[model samples]
Target chain A: MLAGFELIKIAFVGGLISLDSTVFGQFMLSRPIVAGPVIGWLCGDIKTGLLIGAMIELLWVGVVPVGVGVPPDSAIVCIVATAIAANKVPDAAAIAIIFSVPLGVIFKRLDIAHRKWNRVFLPVVENGIENGRYHILTFVIWLGVFLSFIKSFLFLFICVFLFNAILSYILPFIISAPALVKGLQVFMFVLPVLGLASFLASFVK
Target chain B: MKNCNIIRTFFRSLLLQAVWNFERMQNVGFLYSIMPCLKEIYVTDENRLKNAAMRHFDFFNTHPYIANTIIALTLVLENETVAPTGLPSVAASEETKSQQIKSLKLHLGGPIAALGDTFFWARIKPFCGLIAAGYVFIRGFNNIGYFLIPSLIFIFLYNMPHIFFRFFGFWLGLKYKTDVVKIISNFKIQKISEIIRLAGIFVCIFVLIAYIVSSGKYRFAGVLVFLASFILIKKNVSIISVFWGLVIGCVGAGFLM
Candidate 1:
């Protein structure tokens, strides 16, 4: 039950997280194992953050952008899941995490779209180079960084709100049943198992 | 180039994918990085300056951190273009010189990118993650410091090697120019990655055992689930499908038992 301003703050942090993911220093502040717990600690639940972050980190440990291929973003999965689970009970986290998993691919598609739109700047850049306005290159670079921040800010804000509502509706049904509760308990171990599997698979000759 | 200009370019290289486009992935960023040097070199000739800018603006992509090596190499080549010595000390046209630089980037970008992908993206990162994960499993999650220490170490591991390459690698390229490739290859980056991967496999197995041990009553099921997921993942199943399938299966198993 976070306040509106609180959501804005977390989403603001999410935007900053987006910068390090790509299109910037890429210091990997956006990596799940880092950003997840940061967001979780921010939400007053460091354990949930660490748990979710580790899960996502292990699960997608094999995915790296090789050449032109963009891997699904593990950072977003952990961010959304940690935020959701930390703010609520741990029981609902498994489903929230699973549901948020698609966000990695969804963000990848948006990344592709944003990159596609970047073509419009080529003309502007070309014009600048011809006219000797080299400062425009710096401007465009900063503008790209700024736009990336805005996109992730809006994306996370909407996702946190939207997923909260959806999870609230769906979680009660799953949580109320004893069997489902048992399932949720075991579901905790499933992520690491799957995650480790992916890691081993990547190493397979 | 002035020390100040080199410093500026070094910082600018961090945004090497700032305006990445489908048409030319890192073209704008590449231009942006070398712009200061180009300006100083071609100050007297506006035409050369524009040509230089436009030349770098062509399609260019490489690992962002390791790009300093290429940028330094390009700076040397670009300087040579304006100098009478040229690349081979044989008379070469400006067009030929500029074309040479273009092909240099195009040719080197792929190999360096592959090396970077393996070295940083695949090997070092996973190795760091496993270490942090192993700590988490061993320490459990009783205190915030448990998470903080591992996270700090993980970030520290990644940044130490890369930041060194990003800043100092420029000198490697500057000193060697065309021979930078040979110098880079001398490091046997692929072999290092293989060693890192071997270490990562061991850390991963340790983490797995810790996780199962931590599961208490669910240890047997955890082993079963691990085997099933491992087999499926090894057999080429998409992770997300395997994830949801196992989630449903776990929930069902819990319900059935």
Candidate 2:
């Protein structure tokens, strides 16, 4: 539903959110739970965002970046997947988490490329800083933001379309099975406690 | 005899606390111990005060526990009122020397910080976390903060002895550097650090297994499994594992439960 200029703004926001995970930001926004819901709410469905946020939060509870150990694609997992679920299945928490995993890995690769490109751009960045051309620095930062936004929007746009197609194909199968429904619900319940244990253990020295 | 104002000394100690950084370890402790005296007696330039502040900027940023005691001793030594008024004596008595030594240990902040960071924050703190995780797994999350008590208790017991011994070790390291090396050749204290690291690893493995087993096959199992595998298979792990694991796990649990 987003228009041309609007897409650019969304992409900029996504880039800012993604960049925060690294430097010049608190890194708090990088976490999937917080990032996912915030992005979802921006797109207009807080409830769906919350559901997906909560689901992603638990499954990825143990994933924390410390000393160069980047986990699977946390940003995309939350941003793109939540956008899809929020725009589509009002209650698609489990499905979003399952689909997000592979995409998270893909995003990690893209992030590596981003880091490498930053190195290539380092000379320009330094020259800008030295020459007092602050606009150049801003441009570099905006470029990262724009690229991240494009990646997020394109990824999410495709996913939303694909998810719609697949669900249309599979909703009938899911509706026919009461046991699968019950099993899925039960599985969702047990995930968080495991999360607590894992989370608690992280602060151990 | 009277003494230098306690307030001045206390405030200087507080300043040292602010600037303390852990990078050079105990160097700041030694430097800050003398800073109060430096400020009171020597560095009289007002501009130097600002420069000294900048030069010793390490004090503002490092660990506080170690720097304070060092600052405390410098103030104690610098109190002109506490100086003996009589003519310079040739030799001090054994009793006076022992008293001076006792006062030095009490006033010096370095040993305390070193001990506090190592024993309390490092070793016993993790044990407390381990115990807390055990209790939460056994009892529940309604009152998990209660587990903090044992950790506090552990801190007191562990920290006190650690400080006491570290003071002793600092003296011994100085006094017996040659003799100690002769006695225990090639004995780098870092070896002890490695041992502690190994212990931490063992503790990590134990807690991880416990967490997985207790969690069972919850919907977030995929996330949990992925993290565990990431650590085990990739031979790398960090704080990220815990954050993602919790986010994914909590949301799933909320949905299912």
Candidate 3:
């Protein structure tokens, strides 16, 4: 029954958490297991949160940011999906990850655009440094953090209210096999070990 | 350029300098180092240097190490005078013409990019990523504040030598430009590269064995499949392919386990 500023605070935390996936955070720290379940637990649903995180973590296991290949943002996937699903369907973690993929991609594109905007700031940053406007870097990072928090909060608030209102009435209309859902659930728990092993194997030599 | 022309070109290039900045890859620090050089070499001349500098920028984003070498060489080639330090300059030779400099720029662009991608991006980066991932896995991700220290250590361990190699290559390239063909001819693909590759593989095998031993629940089929995938990735398979394959494989294994 959280609402208003409290809701906004959690959503803002989600935003800040998501930022860890790119800059200013350990890329691994943004992985779903940590981000999703933690947020889910905060909102009062551990199983849903863990399930959602595990599912997203596996599917995006290959999405490593190597060279210029910017990986999709899983933080948004975990945050928005966990926040909404925890409040709505208590066991909707699997569905949340599946649904979050598109949102994750959208956020990734925004991230790309953000990078493009960052270009204009480089010279400003350089001039600031040269002229002893040493606070510019701090100003820029905080600006980014504030903007990120606002963006995340708005996205989560809108997504949760709209999706919950619609899905509450419509989920029954859409039918899915229980076996398929079970299989996905099973897949979720198993994939991370495989991912960790494969990732480890890359450095075997 | 003649002495006066060289001075003019330098000043002109300084004025015309355009900083190539981008946000992707977080390589702002790397790009910053080259900006002063860019100003000295490219900015001033609209007709002559601008096109080349822009081209360099396009490739620079894709391949930083190699672009650095080629640009450094270009600066040396453009500025180094045949005349003694203070001697009166003779009229310019055909080689000193701006057109020839432009032509040289075009010729070297592709080779340098290729070299940079191969040496820095292709070889070094993956090695570093793998090492870092391994380090983290072994050390664990607890006490999240300390995570940066490990990552920074990994980066320094990987990239510090690379920085040296880049400078070494550039300085060597300038001094021994004439002996390039002879040096390359003497370069043995097997002698050093294979030795290093073999050592790396041996260490990889040792780690694999150790991990398997430590993992009491390890299955041969799972390990074998993982090894196969590892080799495929080592042989340059698409990363996404290896990833999804393992995902499906693990999911199936989960049913059996």
Candidate 4:
């Protein structure tokens, strides 16, 4: 139910945030803490953004990209959830968080696919260096950045559009039902403790 | 003149993982950054230049931020190859010089990675994030400018230590050479990590209390679920499972209430 202009704005902001994952400086701009609020600010809903951002930040605090493991793309989750909530979809924030958690795994697979595709270009880079065609190196680096931007743009556009459509249908019933509304409120309140516990668990080892 | 090249190399370090590949991790970006320096040093010897480029194509991966120091150190060592007056006589031979540089990179790789991971990932990042999260939690949901405060706090707090360590690491490596590890040991990063961890616990407790007090009808159940989550996490349960478990428990409790 988001306006066309709103969707475009989300896609643009999503692409900028995605750069933090790999393309540009891995400045923690992509962290849910930062990305969520930025998306919320862009949508003019800072409260929802802060709430979702803090929850997702704590939830995935332990999922840092160390060595070779490609953890789920939490940034995408933040964007999707905040976009849904910001648009005033009832119970959309809770539902988005629940559903988007798995979406991260799918985006992570896409990330691994990109890394694999980069490998396909390695021999070309090596050959270019051997032949003194150093320009190929620059081409390959920019190609990686371009591909990352495309991936983020497409993923954000599709998830925001699709989830908003689905929530538009289901939100009315969930909003009207008193039990469901109270349950969701309680669930959101208690969720942060889980995030805090996950964070503390990291220090345990 | 040499200072400009060092500064250029520092900027290139930021892009060190742009062309990361499964084969060599950061080898391509690493080669790209050092290529200019190699070109300058081996200008008269094309084969040596090609050999130098080939030498760096081997596997290499480390914390990108900390790699600045390694790159600076490698530049110093590579420069010694072309101008050998300052280096020890034992390191004078071309073969020995390359070996020393390669071994130095290999030797520094693991320890620097551990240090970077512990300092950045474990301590600085989480500390900054917790500070922001705690700020938002204390402010409550209605504060109109809530998002701005945490965003600013996160960026400033996180970057302060990150930028400082980056410059300090590079300077220490350039000035003291192999004695950089000794300099790093003197920083007592572990103690800093411990203090941050303790502070993080206090913030989490404060937020948990806030949530409990805010819960009207579900106060008792909320306390129970929080205690259960703490015990479950302490028992080494997977985070995802514990999360879903708590969600289901909360919803089920809501139905009963």
User: Which prediction has the highest TM-score against the true structure?
Assistant: 1
Find the 10 residues in a row with the least total lDDT in model 2 chain A: A20-29
Better lDDT candidate (3, 4): 4
Q: Candidate 3 — which residues are off by over 4 angstroms?
A: A1-205, B1-62, B80-96, B138-149, B169-192, B227-237, B255-257
Stronger candidate by lDDT (1 vs 3) = 1
Docking class of 3: incorrect
- Name model 2 segments beyond 4 Å from true: A1-16, A42-44, A87-91, A125-135, B1-257
Per-prediction share of native contacts kept: 0.74, 0.01, 0.10, 0.46
TM-score against truth, every candidate: 0.96, 0.43, 0.49, 0.93
For candidate 4, give the lDDT of residue A26. Answer: 70
Ranking by TM-score: 1, 4, 3, 2
Comparing 1 with 4 on DockQ, the higher-scoring candidate is: 1
Pick the winner on DockQ between candidates 1 and 2: 1
Tens digit of per-residue lDDT, candidate 2, span B1-257: 01353343333332231111123222232333344454554344554333332333232222233333334433343333234446465134323533553455444334444444554344443443343334333343344343233324433544454454434443343345324324222444346545654665575456456555665554256445545644542444443454455446544554565
**Candidate with best DockQ:** 1
Better of 2 and 3 by DockQ: 3
Interface RMSD (C-alpha) of each candidate?
A: 1.2, 12.4, 9.1, 1.9
Which is the leading candidate under lDDT? Answer: 1
Q: B180-221 in candidate 3: lDDT tens per residue? A: 424433655235444544554554455445544545544465
Per-residue lDDT of model 2, residues A1-205, tens digit only: 4445544444455555665444322224555545665667676765555455544554454454332234576666777666555555433555556566677777777665654444444455445434534345345544644565566666655655565467546655754565555545554444444444444444333
The better candidate by TM-score, 1 or 4, is: 1
Q: How displaced is residue A31 in candidate 3, in Å?
A: 14
Fraction of true interface contacts that also occur in model 4: 0.46
